[model samples]
Target: MSLPPADTAPAPEKGGDDLATLAKGGRTNTMGFVIRLVARIPFLVIATRLYGAEALGRFASALVLIEIVALICSLGEKRGLAQRLSEGAGENRSAEVNLVYDGMLLALGYSAIAALLLLAFPEPMFPNGTNSPYDLWLVATIPAFAVTEILLAAQAYRFDIATTVRTRAIVEPWTISIAAGLFFYLPGTRDAGLALAFITSIYAGLLTALWPFLRTYGLPRDWRPAPRAMLGMSASAFPLVGADAIERGTRLLDIFILGLFAPPQAVGIYYAAQQIASLPQKLKTSFEPILSPVITKNLRIGNMEAIAAQVRQVGFWIIAVQLGIALVLAIPGEAVMGLWGPDYVAGTATLAFLLAAEVVASMAVVSESVLVYIARKRNLAISVGIIALQAGLTVALIMAARNAGFGDGYQAAGAAGALMLALAASSLVKALLLKHLLGAPVSNWRWPLVYAAGAAVVVGYAFTFLPEWIELVVGIPAVLATYALVIWRRGFDEGDKVLFRKNVVPAPDASSPS
Candidate 1:
């Protein structure tokens, strides 16, 4: 597990290799984002139309426990692998290859233990479904889920974002969507059909991710990952694992709490809104794989300013894109939720809060990426605190709503509102902490965001006269176009074009305007 000497590590790449790689990855991830957004729609439609809210709610609740366990088993390879690999940048290629292999080995080991535990004590994980095999399918997906992460992380290190685009954005989602459709037509499968589809898609995506890894860095010929090294690597990643779990756990925590206090239908409605909100949330994640290596390389040389500029640049890019998406989706919130079915339109207000949560939380996500490298423990503490506050507020608000005689749907919306308030508060705290740590702006909140918000509001209101179908179709595009035109003209500078340009060398890192 010992790394090569720091003195022997390769010097940072000169020219614009890093930025070009980032730009290429950015384009790939953006394309993936759009594909995923589209692919996810059918799955949502099927879940709503065929299964109903109660069934979907049970599936979501079960899936949450499975995902939490998978995240635990992954040991943060999704983000931590980049940090580990970047540390060995100048070493032999075997070091990089072995890093990925070792991560997979460790993830599999953890997943094996987790799967067995879930099987032995399924009652705790799936309260009402201990006798059902649906929970078995959930545990079965862990290996594919964990290994897919490791391979995808390895390809990301190679700046091969297209592979992730293909596997994750295209193969995984479509596979699940199509599988769900097929399962729906079969008798006796409706209750657990989505679960089966999820397991199948994970395996498919695993295959797709594996091909790229083998093609790029064919099975490390001579390197047999030692058990000691694998264990040490897992131990090392525990903090990252915790941070990642907390970060993702924040979203699921709300659902878990709601399932306890609210009915299944409410959980389903809120989960539906959560699905739509998560699309813009994907914009933040798409930036992470590309940003990690760059930040790690700069951190190695003590280049704080370059790191800060990259953070701000990427942060602004995320905010702009997420805000525009939030506007487009949330402005037509009721219509968008109605796409699921009439019952889901109750989640319209919840959808807006969830979308707003994503908008502010983008800064917190970018800020934490910095802390992952330099101040991981501090980052872990903050993440724990954020989730804690969210859980407390969610429970308190839900209780108050119930005490005030609000319906279960309103109680669910209360939970969503609490999440929004918590995330906004967390973003402010993290942005300030990152600003202090980097001694430069980690977020670029400026007049452009204000102007873009105003423009979105104006355009959103203007579209009220349109039909719901027209509002969803023409209004969304119109709002996006209006927002993008204004933001592009006013907010984006020449340097900011790095986000969109393909394979073009960016100016020196220092020259990037924050």
Candidate 2:
């Protein structure tokens, strides 16, 4: 395929690289979160209204396997692609296009192999007895979903996060929502409609990601399919791939293992809580694609201080937003879960645990972003051990809960508790390790988080006496504003304001690095 000319975008803003990228990513991801929140309501409504919890649980089970495959096939290019391109460009090497092509080639091959395996051996893929012809048909979306990830990563490397927001935050979820709505009206398709809707969304996202990707990064030029070289590249990404899988897989592991022990209703309810918690998780991740290139550039120049400041600043920002979002979401979690149906309201405790897990885990994710570049193998090892701990804890806790005469809801609560404990342990270990390596604090534990939490409880409890609808509508915003005001007054400085695009401050002296 013929390729367009090389990227010729102007230089990033002077003295504002870190703040600029952070500000831009935060804006786009915040908007994306809003779009996703709006889009998810309809999808959840359709699934719960038509298919109910059992069917949704079965769907969640199958999706876990597909997503695991997609994450592996992606080979960590969600961040790795930007790292490679930034390093290549910094060295004045004309290999950015080749790097992009190579990464895509690896993802396609890996995903195709995974899809074929799922198609060939459907039994292992769906051990939950929800296996169907339609489910098998949807396995073909694996490659499309994985490749689109690389395309979006390529766009992110070009500083075009709008494509990611448009495709992931909008096109994908909205398509599934609309398709599920349409399919719900059809007879005999209730069970399979969600699966089909998910497939449609994946391909839609793929097509949508392609045009903007081509416009920005262009096609591969003189790209020969080098099997040996691609394999080597994939080998280099193995640690990254493993880390990403372990990081993402921990969230899904609960559902998969819970399915082995509990019923689909339990899995469905837990999945609902997981969905709610993952929204705040998006705020932290929105920083990753933008942070990767900047971190890579800084690392090359041996700018450890700047890297340290970057980590601390981003970590603080994530914690600030994550805590506030957590408070608002978790405080009215029962009402939030009730939106799906009254049956899901029992997941209130699970939602709280999941939200706390995300809040604590944000520190670990920011720390890992730095560790992945500096001590990749060590970071991968930590991630593997952490997930192993989570899996073991989840199984042990669930079994103990069952034996102790706890109801199914409490049993699932045990699972969430296990997950939160595991994540907290992982965060502590990661923070200490990263701290020792950098000789600086990686996470900012300011007084505002404590004060904000206390205030949120006081405000949230008082509002709970009102109707659930009024409590959620009025209380959520009130809690958010209260938390933000406290954090703004105490936790943030002028630099933090610049990072959030709140105010223009004179740039720091160039003579003093970071």
Candidate 3:
């Protein structure tokens, strides 16, 4: 909850404060992305091999449910915790520390309630629990999961994303993999490894994630918040949590419905595609910790223009990079999946569709970041409505496909693909609405995005002329290099070069205000 003093004796951020802040987040995010990019391959191998298709599918399904429960625990306080705690540290450290305590205690209380609700309605969660006893432990992880997230949010308020990246991107996934490896030698069933690995990683990640935050911003003291204050905070946060839950809920709802209509193995197959698409989202998430605080601080000073500029710069960068990734994946998608196993290549089409949705949602990412400060309720409302509609539509589509005599695999794929489309439509709408709300202009893709998409296609087609193994080695990198070269020439400015030593921006005159 402590704020770094205004006169921290840092150099003046150039290209305006907003642009400087965006550059900072980009640096942190890029570093975090590297960690994830390194971790992902091993993770895919461990998870797919340990759990196989059926159990992996169930794990994926359960994760979606776990996310819903965790949202119940978030109850909307983390966002406010950051904003309020940051405000209090500036104006009143006493109150700020109290607010931090309140946020944690509030999360604990909500998590307790959420746990009870999950226990109380296990049937709805997993009607056929006989096969998945370990799910009970996974469900019990809600409190730890939720509390960990709140504390993490508190850290992000400090503009410290390294802790988050290490815990989430590095430690958590690695821990899960290691645990799976150990459990592979366990005396019990193979299925037990997935559940055990998940639960163990959640707690381990929580412990590791807290170290830096506690080191920099020690534990909050008695500064207990009043019941009324807690209520107000929770109320404000509920919609925000609901909005996130709905988004996550819709993603999982397809698998849940598929569980009832299709074979469990098909659900697992679809989840493979989900995991592949999630890579870009993980990269996008790394920036939020660094960006959110900057955005909120600018808003506090009524710097709307600064906020808009920052959002546009970061949004476009994220979209551009993710677009390049989507292009590479979409081009050699089957080969990429085949690297996992030949059988998993069935998800190639689904990966293409989902990654496309992620591309469109990149605009929504920046817009939502700004909306958190200007008008969260407006953003939450739109997200909730869209997610709900998407869920209902997914169910209807799946049922219709089934009734029309389609196979379970076909219907399941259709529902997931439809959900991806819905997310795309809703994300675009959110981006447009947020643009109006923030009065930020929709960024016209100046370069690389357009050029990269075209290059990806050409490179992808080029791969077909070669053998699979050779294409795997050359085609992917060729497309990536093409995008990178284009972006360097056509997109990045001199400061980016100076930072990464790609280009040298001339030093500013000593008399200049910078």
Candidate 2: 10-residue stretch with minimal lDDT: 505-514
What is the TM-score of candidate 3?
0.90
Tell me the TM-score of each prediction against the true structure. Answer: 0.94, 0.95, 0.90
lDDT of 3 at 285: 59
Residue pairs in collision within model 3: 76-237, 497-503
Worst 10 residues of 1 by lDDT: 2-11
TM-score order of candidates, best first? 2, 1, 3
- Quantify all predictions' global Cα lDDT against the true fold: 0.81, 0.81, 0.69
Compare the candidates by TM-score and give the number of the best one: 2
Model 3, 253-326: lDDT tens digits are 77777766666666777777777777788766556766766766666767666666666667767787788888
* Predicted candidate 2 versus true structure: per-residue lDDT over 1-514, tens digit per residue: 5446446344344345556666667777878888887887778888887778888888888888888889999999988887888766464433677788788888888988898888888775565767346877777888898889898888877777888889988999899989988877888766678888999999999999998777666666666878998889889999989989899998889988888888888888888788878888887788888778778777777776676777777888888888998899888888888988988988889999999999889888988888888889999888888899999999998899889987667767878998899889888888888888877666656777898788888898889889998998899899988888888888787667655574444454321123
171-284: candidate 1 lDDT, tens digit per residue: 988998899889878887755688889889999998998766787777664678798877778778988999889989988988888878888888889899998899988878
Judge candidate 3 at residue 216 and give its lDDT: 52
